[model samples]
Target chain A: MSAPLSLPERLPAISLDDVSRTYTSGGSSVAALEQIDLRIARGETVAITGPSGSGKTTLLNLVAGLDRATSGTITVLGMRVDGTSERELAEFRAHHVGLVFQDPHLLSGLTALENLVAARLPFGHWRDLQAEARRLLAELGLGERLDAPPSRLSGGERQRVGLARALMGQPELLLADEPTGNLDAATTEELIGVLERVRREHDLTIVVCTHDPAVAAFAERVVRLVGGRVDGQQRLDRPGPLEVRSLEER
Target chain B: MALSGALAALLLSGPSHGYELHATLEAELGSTWVTRPAQVYLTLGRMHRDGLVTSERVRQETRPDRQRLTLTDAGRQAAEAWLAGGPADELVVRLAVARLVVPDRVPSLLGTMIEERTAALHRLRGARADDTGGFRAEARDAEIRAVEGQLHWLEGLRGHLGELVARPRVRPADERAAELA
Candidate 1:
């Protein structure tokens, strides 16, 4: 018999080597991020923190293939992300990344289930997509609100719907920008718990950029950015012995 | 019991001196749990007695000898059990007792906690955004929900206590004396 096909070893979820992004307007050039070298391993959770105008979003945009770097290389999921055509980048993103933003930007007219269904429609049959969307929305604690329009849902609920929509594509890497910025403290905590649970369930690699220490506390590693450069990096010890439980036990 | 289990779990990670273990636990738990060094040592002693952990005295260079503790097979199993178990119910009992004894202060205490947590959440929200992607955003959302749940529970508890206990209305002694006059 022919040798059974084996899956390739997982590569770094993201790698940015000497990456920089500069924007020029009116004969003045502003460097958003300068020479950032970062490698995030598969399934690792990292938080990038800095002050405003510190190029935090710039770094995320680069990795998501939303924006090309002005210089250097960007690799995501073992593919070159820095030098790809727009069409190629779009395909790579659709296949490998799930993006969440401050605003869910969900269609206001669509029901929660419909919103998720819309995200998956391009990739699967409508019947299967609708079932998958229902499953995701239910998993995200939106089972009751599945038929509710975005306008009727609370800010937190809408965000959860957005998250479910993101998962509809089943991207390996999840990238969120200020996902909790629109939420109050209580909602933020609930969303964080949901994210953690989802991450564990999906076996995903996640990168979040935030100024909040409370949010950073959830990350295994925290990278500090300042003036468009990496200032410091620290590995946060997982809190509590309860985390020692095996995945099956959890 | 949780602390003892936590200590054992730490050992399961690898062998370390008492002080090192204590530091690691403190770092891990942060302000969530206040762990005294003495409590850690006491638990270590108990765990050693139970044969859940074994210790070896290592002679240091120009320093005091330290006991390097390691988890035994039984200890590893016990640690896993502890990890799988739910949190203690003592917290609920303690809160119930506090509600009875100090009903008036309960709301204020809860309010203070809510304020602190809200401030922390806002601080996190205000932190410079980074590109780590959707995972951190998801993590933040989870945190927001947790804090919101606590606030909701506290608010509900406050309302319940308010209904159960009415603040006593007392006339001032001077007012009574004036009325007598």
Candidate 2:
């Protein structure tokens, strides 16, 4: 019998090699992160978790090309992100990376559909964008709220809109910073459900920066950031009966 | 009875040193905790020496040392009795202890901990619904449905918790919040 081939290890969508960030404040240099090394494979959902000032947010910004590093190289979606020019990074983010923050920085005047359609403006096509936006919203259980503005939408609904806005461009990589940071308990759980469904359906790579264990539980791997460096990691699998039993037993 | 009960409750699940027990409890309580592994091992060693339980060296591939542990008949009985009895105030106290010690981390830790619990509940529900035919056929659908319902409820709770941890709190019962005004 021919040897069965295992699933090919997916190529990393993001790589940070010996990356570090330092800030000079009042003639004293503070290290935000140092000696960071990470690899995020395509289609993988990885959670970056830590306490405040642990460099979790800094790591996200670096990957999204929102900020530059003081040392080492960051490669995002096959482009060298660390040394990329400002224009290059902006273009790269627009084309390859989709960002969602804790707060839905949605345009106040725009409807949910309009906000989603806006992602296509930079690329100059709004026709298909609307249809895709509707499809995404409906899939995320927001079809009824599509015409609502940010002010009228509930916390969960708004977060779904923000998620739809991110997916409107169909970017290969999604970087979210505490996407549920401003919701109620019920809404947070609902948002996580939507995220789980979308992640599987879209087959997109998502890196979420959160300290919430609930959020981390969904990720295949949870990387701990400490003192601005990769500290340790926890590997989690889809919880099964055996695992539940183990947990209960534990 | 309180200390013995909590200790037993932890032990009933499996064998753990005092430190690991503390960590698990802290995690369950959703607090920023500091329980050194060495300290746990020390307690286990002492417990072993005291005849509360018997332990043996267990080799783990990823660990540096063989963890010494095993619950004896006395230990299991103690654990079961403790858990079966009732809740203890100290259970909350330990969590408070962890929270107080790590005062700066209260909000973040609580947020993370709530998230973890919510996720864990979802996962447990999902696990129960697997089409393995392991669960009874008659109870399967009802159980799965119940799990799904709980998952939804947990989401709502998590959302509310998120809002509480962060900004201006909105009273769910308040007419303004109801109107989104």
Candidate 3:
């Protein structure tokens, strides 16, 4: 491992400079995101908000190394994400990034806890990942449901389990897309609170794409996307109900 | 009772004055909620006595003391329960509370509601198709048509979505039909 992290100050968790992504089909193309520039400092929580076709998921995929930029550059943990080979990118993500989705991809037959255990089985950190999975599940209030299969758990419980699996890798960066999309208000609040505590305790940098104002309120900054571009960015000061939008807009 | 639940749900964010709560409720629920100032104050007073909210008089330098209100732990729990609990008949009140409590989730809630109704409609039609023409067949078909109309209206909302809700990414008709089948 090159271990590029010994710099003077740990570099920003994520840096994107003039990035653009285009998809081509039938000799025509669609620009999913263009002229985007953003930087997320270490240990900060930022929320990405937007309507459909706004490239919110595209941005997350690009950061996670699941997709590549057509131009420009992406640097995460002081490593170049754009130009990295697929094998290198996979290796980097396994060591650094955690991903949570609206519908978590868990093995149907496995128990909640086992799902986590099996994720890193290929990498052979069985004991460490298991310990982390158990601790994370307990902390997330799913300790009682640890043995339940995915189908048996409630939507909220399953999402919490998804979070535990994400944390098992001990990743420094967490990317969640519509994490609270199917959750109830109380569950949403609880999950966001958990994320906040994890960020504080672990010094993890989080980038979440959400539609919920509560998520935006808890974030250090909110970056809004529109028509594949950065529409607005705001650093919040716990403005409570007004944090997401103004009274007039509501 | 719905307003009382709504009030409890609103304070889950934190503290607020009665006026601000009323204004926020009015803004969120819009014309559907026509609560008056006196009603809001009366309800707050009642909630204070019931231990749902704690009220304190915050003294301003240039003005009279204003009553500031905050939710008790009990209040928060009750609101959480109320926000997450609703039968089909209570959908309107429940959704209003959801919109007020978690504005970011309105679109998701709406989408879930629509899918559920559509599924119910499909079941009703399925039962009719396999029926032997019972005595109540006509009445049952009417109920099915009503649900179909509601589903149409809900689907229609997606087309004219505003800034608050994301415009849904509709799948191909064939895909949706296959899933439903």
Candidate 4:
């Protein structure tokens, strides 16, 4: 007898088909990303990596709806990011995506807890979000310094606050650009640890654009872009942990 | 990288004693962290010497002697330092070595590695650690992630080197970053 089909409540968190972005300036044109076909399933983590102009951010921006692609379709949690109206995109971002930038731009005057709470201020009552903000800070190991303002926090602490702020939206998908661009090795490692934990706890599908291999390596899959094209991709499904096999050139 | 700090965090909230600490660590961080009791005790002995923690043997009736480990002021400070974090190095040296020696082979493997590393990272982080174990799971997760990161970086080195030495420039990555801004 055929078994009943069981499907996940939600499947791929993000889908991109023949996606491309070209910026035409004065008389010339530049392709930041070209023909990008990618899929990220629910609870997956993917890293987009490339050189300075490989369109890592452009690809991320397209999925985020911060920028539209010249061609192709981008679907995130069932919504069309490319063709959606600005208002719809804005709403989608507010409700579905969490963004962590290279540098977490926190309101200088606000305390760490306040910054997290304030991000969702426009969406809900301040009091309702306060507890969750506190929990996030504590979970990130910043509970002891919740009252500290951005100026008072260390580079690592500030980044943790930034992450906490991102989680405030409770979005299903997270997008980060060079999140560790500013941190030291030890701190970067620490932040990656936090990110790893949060993604699982929150059941988030994360897409990060980074130049750091350490950061990219932490993802479930790494997508490499060369000259704005999908040059190659690999899945880290091999057995063993911390196994270092040097590349023996063919 | 920061194993001591995490080891300290495990003892901070609840000063696990004897078999308790060893059992707790195993339960909280899973095999991704220190699993053996002897290793945990050895670490405790080192921590005892470092003044990050204090260890005491409390005898019980008809049972083995319980080792009570408590976090010291310095241990607490160490945990705090971990939270504050330190400056990061820009380059990953292992990958640099691969690029220096296996330049060609490095790219094919490296390009694939970035993908594999990402996947590796996802699976590592996706492993279930203790949910309510306070900072214990977090510290353990950090330790695992940091170690995995090193391997991933080493693999990724070739990919970047390949980009620099090989591959005709179809377009630069940030050529539009300036204009897009």
Candidate topping DockQ: 4
Q: For residues B29-52, what per-residue lDDT tens digits would candidate 4 score against the true structure?
A: 455544476776677778889998
Ordered by TM-score, highest first, the candidates read 2, 4, 3, 1
DockQ of each: 0.04, 0.10, 0.02, 0.16
Worst lDDT 10-window in candidate 2 chain A: A241-250
lDDT of 1 at B170: 34
Query: Over the true interface residues, superposed, what is the Cα RMSD of model 3?
Result: 19.1
| Residue range A61-102, candidate 4, lDDT tens digits | 888899989999999999888768999999889998999998
Misplaced by over 4 Å in model 1 are: A1-10, A237-250, B1-181
Best by lDDT: 3
Better of 1 and 4 by TM-score: 4
* lDDT agreement with native, every candidate: 0.72, 0.68, 0.74, 0.72
Candidate achieving higher DockQ, 3 or 4? 4
Candidate 4: fraction of native contacts reproduced: 0.40
Minimum summed lDDT over a 10-residue window in model 3 chain A is located at A237-246
Which runs in model 4 stand beyond 4 Å of their true positions?
A1-10, A237-250, B1-106, B109-181
* TM-score of candidate 4 versus the correct structure, residues matched by position: 0.62
As a whole number from 0 to 100, the lDDT of residue A190 in candidate 2 is 70
Error of 4 at A129 (Å): 1.3
Candidate 2, B67-176: lDDT as tens digits:
54567787766654443323222334322332323334434544444344444444553453345665554354454344445434433443444343343322223334
TM-score of every candidate: 0.56, 0.63, 0.56, 0.62
Scored against the true structure, residue B165 in model 2 reaches a CA lDDT of: 36
